[model samples]
Target: MKLPESQVAALNAASATDETPIDRLAEEAGLKPETATQAVFELRDEGLLEVTERESVEYELTDEGAEYVESGLPEVRLYRTAVEAGTDDAPAQMGRIIGASGLEGPEIDIALANFGRKGYGDIDSGELSADPDADADDDPEAAALAALAEGGAVDDVDADVLDQLVSRNLLDRHERVVRTITLTDAGVTALMEGIETAETVDRLTPEMLTSGEWQDVEFTEYNVEADAPEVRGGKTHVLRQTAERVKDVLVGMGFQEMEGPHADADFWINDCLFMPQDHPARTHWDRFALDVPPIEHLPEDLVDRVESAHREGVGEDGDGYHSPWSEDFARAVALRGHTTSLSMRYLSGTEVGELEPPQRYFSVEKVYRNDTLDATHLLEFFQIEGWVMAENLSVRDLMGTFVEFYEQFGITDIQFKPHYNPYTEPSFELFGKHPTTGELIEIGNSGMFRDEVLEPLGVEHDVMAWGLALERLAMLTTGAEDIRDLHGTLADLDFLRGAEVTY
Candidate 1:
């Protein structure tokens, strides 16, 4: 079920021929190729396969494999011998395709005996047969293919041999594809004898569509559609939709929308916030810095204050903090690491002077980090960064904001543990129990700006800065197991189209 709707749509091999290989079964089953293949092995594992390894490389499982595959539990395999010979206890049609040509049993024996006793030249099974001796070894592969072809799909390679033949005059092992194809639930059903589709009927339309009751009915007309239910879907782009919903939640709570350029200098980013020049985060490796005409000036007053602070502890301790300010560092351009950088920028920009009681602002945008990408991490991602400027915006005010944001997501169990961030004093990381998996997942970080960081910027009252990771929020809201789901390219339109969300 963790499989996204896009993945479900791509699993098409379920409708393929039974003889098709597992690698190519994806399309028919309406699943990814890998999903189909995995489904095949699953069927076999569950004691549902009647595998017939007709060829050395490929094995064919009977209809049981196909049945199990379609049932969605393809991981079960019930393997049986490829073929069986006739015996006293054996059935009349053991391993035989027909009465005798493919059947191997006592019935074949009786037919062969009746003919052989009449001085028949040859006998096979229970039939008077002209035994054709074939030297398949003359062309081992060709013979195998011919035999496999006549036997009807050796487990999964249903494609024509000519395709492989066209590849070359000289057979290269590397060029060869050695893989097994198994029938999915649909494929097995299709290959089964007497398997007939329902009589074509006019698609039953809902009265709502015809009555013009729903003008927003934007669904495309489908001439034909399989009844098979795909992982249910249709929604806004998962990330963007979730972003909008989250935006609404904050905005509804009186948060003004804020925006900033993707690129910013250290002055607005980290410098004005009192990030030490020698801090590792300000290093070139940590930030995506720009080199064009390096060095931009900070606000003259702010610059003087910052410079004076470096010259002498500008705030609480104007002693040890007195160090040299790096204009170059301030000038250095880089992609914003945290949206908190933007919050800083917004605060430094032309202001509303004071909170005037209470003022809130927020933004949902991309942030860049020079870090290794993994299931839980990415190089670039969106962040929902915001802050509330209030006359009495204390640590409690920030916590209230957290509660308000999560409540909109229908989340109630919040873990507000004290943590630390470079820019915010008395910082804390907010964690919420994941709805699906009760695991504690960190959603965002929040705290009050330190006076050392604020005083240099000017006219600043208490402004709380909280930079939220969008991926984490999505993981919390959608119960997505992987953070990459937010940025997945294979994602289908329905993956995020009409999701249940709240403001």
Candidate 2:
């Protein structure tokens, strides 16, 4: 029998009695893993080898995990400190124990959270108690971390402990397919009869063509059904592709693109949109404030008009918040919570030279917020911001626009619930039915700008504007259950690689 050189080597290296891993077989055959893999598949096709695949999980300590392994898990450290502080005998003041524990900032919270969960102690009404029977040295999480750090098998660790470590961002788990190759009876028979290496050409070269030897050489057969190595080539991210599609769709709907600073003056981000100076959303907890110098150059007349709108109202029928609006606060810089700042800038005629009535402008840009990370929320994500300025615009026009816009993405079952926004009158929150869960998810927010908002921006004509979440739109299109799956630290690479941003 004759075979390719790589196949001959693999068969010679494979064992008849023991199943050898593909990696070890490749090492013994002095061949690359991919070459050995292809050869193994070819031999298996001819019933000369048996190939089986098994999935193995590997665990590695994250940076935080390594730190904890070096200097005790936060909970364990807190427990030891609490025991030394006599908390086991009597409840001690939580602050003193925590201070003595030397846990600072986020670590203190981590310690307190896990301290109670590990049955190490109890925290109640600003006091901490330790369980005398609970041994801090026997913590499963800490033991698991130490085992992983020392290259122990994943099976040696408790599953729940591993899960807890993963949830705490202290460990990373990865699964890999391990393939093993074993010789079949046919393979042993072939080896006993002796096999020869066949000279075969997989590709026709220019030299072969010039020498006219292509016809004389045997061409290697291709096994298209073989499990080949995965090639993850560079391509546009699904989110970016969706964002680009959005831009194209908006442009087709007769809207021009808008662009501006990601971090800008609060004046354009909020105050220009009639958000009161003292609004809760303006506080540091909700916005990423910057320490840069205040905005020195603002249109003085526009500022006066905006302040007057905040102080005295827009029209005779309009009413202002009458809050103490401060120019200093408005000039403060921060990351834009929404791309509505671009809308504010464009509508105020500061961008694109004062867009005229019957103008449409849109921006698919990133926004930052101090939001809690969850399945539906992210601290930073793209926002699809847009506005239409024309006379006699009504709620019907707003709803019709959304219908047409979403239909392009095959989302026809959009539901809108009346909501409230500080700048938009009769605001509506747009919801879309999830393709997988069959549940309605809030996708975006929209409404017509109120007189307090539009009048301050010098937009006399009725203007309808919306700040839609780009990630949520992507989630709806991709059938992703979690926004984190789309793009974030916890993103699923497999999902991203396979997700098609279908229109």
Local accuracy by lDDT, each model: 0.55, 0.88
What would the per-residue lDDT of candidate 2 be over residues 377-465, giving only the tens digit for each residue?
77688999999999899999999999999999999999999998988888999999999999899989999898888876777799999
TM-score of each: 0.54, 0.79
Query: How many clashes (backbone N, Cα, C below 3 Å) per candidate?
Result: 64, 0
- The regions of model 2 sitting more than 4 angstroms off are 1-16, 29-54, 60-143, 158-222
What would the per-residue lDDT of candidate 1 be over residues 321-386, giving only the tens digit for each residue? 444577877877888887776666667664333334366788999988765434466667888888
**On a 0 to 100 scale, what is the lDDT of residue 330 in model 1?**
80
- lDDT for model 1, please: 0.55
By TM-score, how accurate is candidate 1?
Answer: 0.54
> Best candidate per lDDT, number?
2
Highest TM-score scorer: 2
Residue 290 lDDT in model 1?
75
How good is model 2 by TM-score?
0.79
Candidate 1 — worst ten consecutive residues by lDDT sum? 73-82
